[model samples]
Target: MKNWFVALGGVLGYFALIFLYTLGAYLLVRSPPWFRYLFGFSSLSIFFGLLARTFHWASVAHIVLAESILIGGGTLFSLFWAFFSKKRPDPGGGAQRSPEERPGKSDSPATFLPAEGGDEEADLPVSRVREEIGTLLDAGLSVLVYGPTGSGKTSGVLMECLRERQAGDAERSILLISCSDGMEDYDLLNRPVPASPQEKARTLRAMAREHPDVRIGSLSRLFGDWDRAEGPLRSAFRRAAGGERLTIVFDELNRSSVSALNLILKVMDPVLGHYELFDFTTGERLSCPLDRLVFCATCNMGEGYGQTRELDWSLLDRFPGVVFMDYDARLEKQMLMDLGVPPDLAGRMVHVALALREAHRTGNLAAPLSTRHLKNWGRLVADGADPENIAPCLWVNRLVSHDRLGFPDKDQVHGIREVLGRTFRGGRKS
Candidate 1:
């Protein structure tokens, strides 16, 4: 009896330890960077202490443990402070729109809010992009907005949806699917997920009903197995068919693999009323209908964007509303000025961006400075960081690759450096 009890306790302890480790790993992966770093530091410190005890290296262990604790603690505290201390800008009032101007039942026209320097109309490109998206939604067609990185393609679609939510469209559901080259067909259809307690109870009840001869207690233990959950694409389709207005946004759509895209093509067809998916649980084909589903995707194509393939015409043909967006220098400059950057400095930053774009076009540089980069540069300048000093880090380093000598690409870096120097001349004398 004693031996059996010992064996049972050991088995339970082993399983409990495994469960804790698995749960910790799952949460650690999704935790923020600073938390991850702190965890790593603690793990390393324990490892070093164990090694030191085995080898009797007391002094070295002490120094290392002290340094790790100080550095890790300081990093964690600083990240916490910065996160809490940063002031968030207020969400200004949005322009009111009547119901006649609304696009679909869920998606409404984006409201251009008032800005400091000028009225809302001054932000032309953003408003125009939003209007275009609203118009596409109104036509009952899927929208695909393609542009360079950081050109606000995704934001334009999101802003339109946000306006709907703000306008009391509570029934609207926005399902965001972030596409990548490694994504699988099953990732977009359905996959096995850990079953919740409620789901397990429901499954147990169903099993009991199917097999009236078996006891529910015996079947309950087997309910620990994972349950299948539909992926975002299938779930959105199901909800839309069930009378819910679903906005499915596939971000970085061009980065998805050919297989994933092919699977998606079946359901993306507007003419096709239904798409089929194999149900392993029921051993049958489940046909899901498409209704009230507004499909939207953001694609980053052209040069400078790696790990992205050219979209096939078959995939492109599914989207009737395709909008091409690019960096708008005028709007970018106005935004920078609004961020408290001096007008002259803001203009010069845009000039630098244009020069880099020209270099990229001429094949002299691998990538151009985007408006996002300009905003960062402008912010740093506004904070009193020397533009010329930080230029190498803020943009130049990003545009060039390290050579065999472990230095930034000599020719490309030199060209960007020249552009920065010329653009920031006498501007940094303050």
Candidate 2:
């Protein structure tokens, strides 16, 4: 009975040491990939050392021999697990099939596998806000979509418009302008065009005949290049005025200059029904009617977006249809699975993203994991890259890079590492 109790005590003590070691490592360790082995080697060494001290079970030589034997066995098993275990297929579940293979399912994760010679664009992850945008466009109302980065505002809307345009009418014109801080009124309305040799000579002769007293320096005006070319905006306006269906998409509208915004406002004035495009070279204004025109703009308006202007309230009022897009958990997970990530793995990725987004909301994190990041992560994981190995490069560094406090917010980074360790531990292998 005494021997039995001593044996029980030994087992309990060893396990207790293991628990403490695991907890400490989890809380303190930065690199999780190597932490498990570190815990195992250190805990076994300590436990064996303690047993030898307390029970006088073995001499130093004997203890060293036992440790070597046990550690060698563990090392061999680890090698087997690393090199051979992965060759076997998963018994729990068969291979995942593409969405088209399974029908009557619209709500589940649609694993998109394009057929031979299939169109990949047709398989893009569908956004919920797309329907609303379509409804507004059909009603002849302009749309404004405001959302966080990577919420699929620009790509989703642009793809949907392009698809619709291709399917419905090839003659319908679509114009996409990615607005920037440097965008000016002239950049939108019109721009100078280099004059051809013949045109320049003709203009110079006509100017000389009309204003012979004009100085040689004033002859520079005879070059006549200003507003000779119509920009995307003007070209779309003219096409819409000519009874062709037109869709104009302005991406990152908040980044546009004040002059560009004012120009947009004037051009979208519904009461006027017709807007004038100035010909700077000829001093003429051509009136273009607004017919069959649909305008849409996307803006990123929140923290972590630098150099973005607060949109004018008047401009916001012009959009009869407004959508606030955000990351859709179900859709995002579906997208991951579609990219060939295991369902369980996809779920965990979405969970981490949601947790990070909450942290961002509370100002604990500078930015959250975006759909773009998740897609990239998913593709790598699907291709057999270890999630734990690539996470630091893909997810962790990205969050740390944008930390407003500094390049790496240590406290925040520690928190992120902890979250990742907790979530990714024992995760599905691929």
Structural similarity to truth (TM-score) of each candidate: 0.59, 0.60
Largest TM-score belongs to which candidate?
2
**List of clashing residue pairs for candidate 1:** none
Candidate 2 has which clashing residue pairs, if any? Answer: none
Candidate 1, residues 273-329, lDDT tens digits: the string is 764545343454545455456677898887567799888999899888898877877
Evaluate all candidate structures by whole-model CA lDDT and list the values in order: 0.68, 0.70
Clashes of 1: 0
True lDDT of residue 108, candidate 1: 11
Candidate 2 local lDDT, 245-349, one digit each (tens)? 777889999899998898888777765776555544346555655656677899998646888998888989878888888886777878889999988777777
lDDT of 2: 0.70
